[model samples]
Target: MAGSNKDIKVAVIGAGALGLVTLKNLLEEGFDATGFERKSYVGGLWKYTLDETTSVLPSTVANISKQRGCYTDFPYPDDTPSLCASSYIDDYLQSYADHFQLRPRIRLNTAIRAIKRDDANNKWHIEVAPTASASDADTETITFDKLILATGTNDKPSVPKIEGMDTFKGQVLHSQTFKKPEDFKDKSVLVVGIGSTAGDSAVALMGHARKIYLAHRHGAYILPRLHNGRSIDHGLTYNLMTVQKLMQRFAPNVATNMFTKFAQKIQDTAFPSIHEHPEWRLSPAPSLRQTFPTVSDELIPGLESGDIVSVPGLKRVTGPNSVQLDAPKEGDEPMKLDDIDVILFCTGYVNDLGMSLLEPRVHPARNTNPAWLALPGSRGKPLARLYRNVFSLDYPDSLAFMGAAAFATPAFQLYDIASMAVAQVWGVEAHNTSTLPPKAEMERHVDEQHAWILEYARTGPVYPQLTKQFEWLAWADEAAGTNVGANLGWGAQGWTFYLRNRRLYKLLTSGVYTPHLYRIFPSEKRKAWPGAREAIERMNQQLEDELKTKKV
Candidate 1:
């Protein structure tokens, strides 16, 4: 029951928005933490729910950019509107958990139910309950030395088992239970995924659908949450981790044809009809990089008013009013689609519900679990092995995993710099436990980040165990000193200025001048942070003078 007051506590789990900024950066690193959150309040998935395990849609906004999707000690209200809504990022994450009182250390409505570890007091246990369990069932458990797992990956909704989709007849939703498109008003839907909830839920159910339909197996790169008006991640995803290490020092087909022709010239000026289908892109394997998409502030308009249409994959389930599709042009024949009253499925979730709180005590049948992070497949799913995906090479310092990956960082600045590098690797065993590291150097950094995420993620996506948010928060502040890599002042002379002019020092330090001029100050004996780098350089120079005075 873990309360002998041995002192070293911490339990975390999921209060969302990276577990309330990893319980306020592990209570500002003193760390006698708590947390929980099975919702009763807290903006996990930015709140706003009709709750089908939250995936957000109903035209969900804030697809990053309330100035890099805020929260490094709050900054969203300059009369709020630098791309707002998803209820203003769930009221700026419930006013950043009640402005840091962190609502009396979290635990609302609870619900864990099994974490187990104890291993002769190495500590962990967990088990919890209460989503209102009174029938007879009960739980409680407790214990803890460490165990963060800040429920990152939008849990639930990985749908996709087509073939008869459980004999689909009519209404079949699941864009994480889509909050409300007036429940497809005049009906005739059919959405399906390519994401950003299949193009903003087919433009928020095209004014109450009488015809909608978007389907899709490929051709994405939707983008545009304001391009020329700024914040279409203001170029190179406004700092793709030092532009993928200065384009992996060039010459990989010259950094993949110079960042895929600058992401096909920003999708030929904001999606010229999805760049006129370079054969519906996503690759028949020729290095798929239309430069990340499925973004959308709103842009669907074509079909000359017949009311939205795109259809292509899903060649099955034909009756209960039709659905065949996939053929058009490969000898042209598979159409069907007929009257379909509703089909939705913006299909996304499945970031492994924290793989039933992992059990792996030295290969107990090796299921290094994150619900199988996939790859040795017959169709991959469920996997986890983290070396730098936040510890856990078979439970090092008792499990840690905040926000698992940073798909384009700033979701709590890479989960508060990997939860303050797991409290600076548990304050390195109270003074230099041989400055940590070994365990085959964390299994060779999780087998070189799982062979660099199976290089190009083999053709599936979510692989972001943080692709460079200031080089993984300066390699977790140089393997856990947590000064956030000494405030990225990284001067060994900037690796000899990135080995001399690596693309003009990565286009003059990935904009916002020097990749967001530093902030993780939990102490390196108090360096900069007072004025926080000149108020983020006068708010990135008044957001590049308000995106260069937007007019067009």
Candidate 2:
């Protein structure tokens, strides 16, 4: 723990949003951290790829948001649009890396194959291979005191294997494969999935596609991006900072109920008036989807003009030029479309950490299902068994996967937290206590989190009422004594004030507080409790009077 800083060597995989943030933090903390990006460029998914036509769109490769998707610490420039193009985001990321002096540490076009524990030296042995085009043919193994896996979730596009997907001759591609609306211009297109990606993609194609069908297996709770000429996401932000605290304090059930009710309210407000058909169908609101910029203002009118047809789930891809849809309502006849020229599946991605490394321990017969692990990879071996969503306890320093857990806000925030924790364990920091969580406890926590997500999803979007999941994550990180607390832009006092002063006065008066409740309080003890409290109260009164008079 007392070693010189020169002794530390950290390698971060994936130089995307999460990777870049981790690299920034590591550099700030004075650690010798290097980054490896598979792409020749810095931005991962933000790097735009084109379809046959060249119009910019949110295809698998195009950048999504420029300003909205960036780090909270470094606000995107004011000139940037809310929904930024992919190129803008890439430029922003490159600028961020440059600003933080992280460019020198990055090794572009490098790919990490496997991370194994070198038990003898208490270090990590990471196998590195250049991308196909790299001049280096042989894979080289590098040893590091610590390893951070920021390889984000977006790298792998989720394309479900429909029975006759390959038979679709006209064109079949995942949302990732989409680049411009012109590709679908004057052509019939079927956009599959109800998640934000699918929704946005469908909206984008409305201008060009001759006939656009937005299909989903289940109904999703549709809420407007704006209400009454104001941004709905902004309202959610305000409510998250205020209402959530009040509910958690005075009435827990009431707070939970509010999310559902609010979501319903938003859905109601969004339909008929804003959206053409508000009552089409309701599905669970995808939390990750909220992070992306909602459909732009220019596109909303078209959505209302009936350019986009909301269709039920896909039954099958009948042929190269046609597809079938299950009726939206039960007992209704199936609808077939014979002239569709393209199908874009916006189905979700699977979290698969390639299982080539842990073969013997995670063989199929062992019943180590990857789903059981919570972090996907091989069957029988759930990644949840690792401590703090970090190292595998059974395989000491063998592997650590960052940015695995799905979060509402930027995954980079959590990745940064994970990276810091890894740094602490590696003794790269002055004081290291990141490995405190026992493997068993970490596994239980992950299990509970998964259970919570499944139940939340099953129940449907708790909108307006549901606590912003990111806030809870921030609190969890704080309790774990991680850097997430510092990264929390606003102070905890906002929610604390709403709950303690307004909603649940009884609990505050009763002096009954849960252990979780105490984590938010300052650690210092008050001396001369009654006198100190009275003096503080007097100062508050004086401050209030001066503010009332508009005099500081």
Candidate 3:
């Protein structure tokens, strides 16, 4: 169903980084696109708020380097810190909106009330209301030919139900509600979970809280932001995406072993020796295959300095302001933590699509297939059975989800490419419809991916976006017809393109692998920017300077 962009109208929800990019791509493709954000301002989670929205903690810093964190065409300002703060991220996003002139089309303080697709007419009927308006009657209906859900994966906070949490009278707060360090002044706090948020909050509250207990059942591989005096993403991990893909494809066993060793080396250097501590009840160190490593620079030092007390899994609340903990070791006595003035859960967010925004008919988990319904950890949790975690299997043509997947790499370019793919598919029928695989085939791919994830995440709720960077990038490139792999000898030209363009090929292979590389070559549906090469060179030179001044 190739359609002229002159008549196509697209509705993009959530004007965060992801949504902004989607709107930009849709507009560039000549479609009439409008963005709707529930919050009064843009920058979804990056915009810190006291409300229910999940955002960065006050001490949050860029785990991924600024170079990788930026959009393809728009690099972060040269003065931006190596590991910039959340405020810098927010400002960068706002600047992006301003640079693209996207503010005029964005409707802030507008929340999507209901979304129902008219099957007969092949159109979306979206009911929107003022974010402050509580009444359903104060809504207006708008029609669009296509819908893009940029609402993001981290909007809803996932708070765990702890036994006897009701009895704790002091204070209970999720990381989403954590305002500032002063709020916990002189208070004995319990930080549950060892995710990035947990580490950041515990470190941030070091001097503020009188006592801080960092609780987790399993041992986490907490990596430092810097590896070898450079940001982790600026070095090996960022440069090895294509290499990882090739090795995994050609020599799976060899690649797995090498990667395991590489990860172990990083863990040995970055993570503290807390794993061998006699008092803490952290479980055995899990393999990289089991879970992703958390990036934190100060958590280990804080633990070692006795600023943050590491404890075992919480059993239950023995009494108000007191909690019973599991034994440090088997047959060891259980520990009790008392005088806890505040309990802060640093648990991650949920990406379930069962929110009231969309009707059940177009729900992300609308598929009735038994295989699709059997979600790991979450039996009935609604997840989008999306192909490549972007296109809705049920309505791939008219509906898409941006920034749905989390990866080891940066999200800016990944979502940008996804948006481009969506544009190509929706803008021209021959570019996508005729080239797209059948729905059944797409469903089968989704099922296989879910099966792979289920095998690893057998216990906890698996977020659908937990995918490998290389695999997802390859899939997105194929859909967008970008032929990014061509330079790497993984496409039609194979290795010939490397010879034809040695300078660009060398940069692509050995350089910093910045986000701008995605915009280096023009495609049928995408035009390359002349500044892409300059951006890449600048980033590479910046890295060289950093390496010269700093010692590993």
Maximum-TM-score candidate: 3
Computed on alpha carbons, the lDDT of every model, listed in order, comes to 0.63, 0.55, 0.78
Clashes of 2: 23
- TM-scores for all candidates: the values are 0.33, 0.73, 0.93
Each prediction's RMSD over C-alphas, in Å, is 20.7, 8.9, 2.6
Q: Rank the candidates by lDDT, best first.
A: 3, 1, 2
TM-score of 1: 0.33
Give candidate 3 misplaced runs (Cα > 4 Å): 1-3, 237-239, 250-254, 275-278, 281-283, 353-355, 366-381, 429-435, 459-461, 490-494
The parts of candidate 1 lying over 4 Å away from their true place are: 1-138, 145-147, 156-169, 175-189, 192-212, 215-261, 266-292, 295-308, 311-338, 347-401, 404-420, 425-428, 432-552
- Candidate 2 lDDT by residue in tens digits, 1-552: 437545677778778777888777667556778898877777666666653311235442222232124453454555665445566677777788888888789998776766676667867777778854334457888888766666655545556557777788888878766877787889998888776677768877866899887776555556554455433432333235445666756786777567667666766555644443543443433432222223334233455676877677788888878787888677988888898888888774433433343334531113433333443212122333444445554543435655555434444444544554454454434444444456677567656654543344343332111223544555445433533233223457544554555633322222211111212323111011123223323323443453477542
Q: Give one digit per residue, the lDDT tens place, for model 1 in 270-356.
A: 656543444343333223331245667564443334466776767687677688878745787877777998888876665664655
| Global CA lDDT computed for model 1 | 0.63
Mark the 10 consecutive residues where model 1 has the least summed lDDT. 282-291
Error of 1 at 78 (Å): 50
Error in Å for residue 497 of model 2 = 13
User: Candidate 3 clashing pairs?
Assistant: 2-429
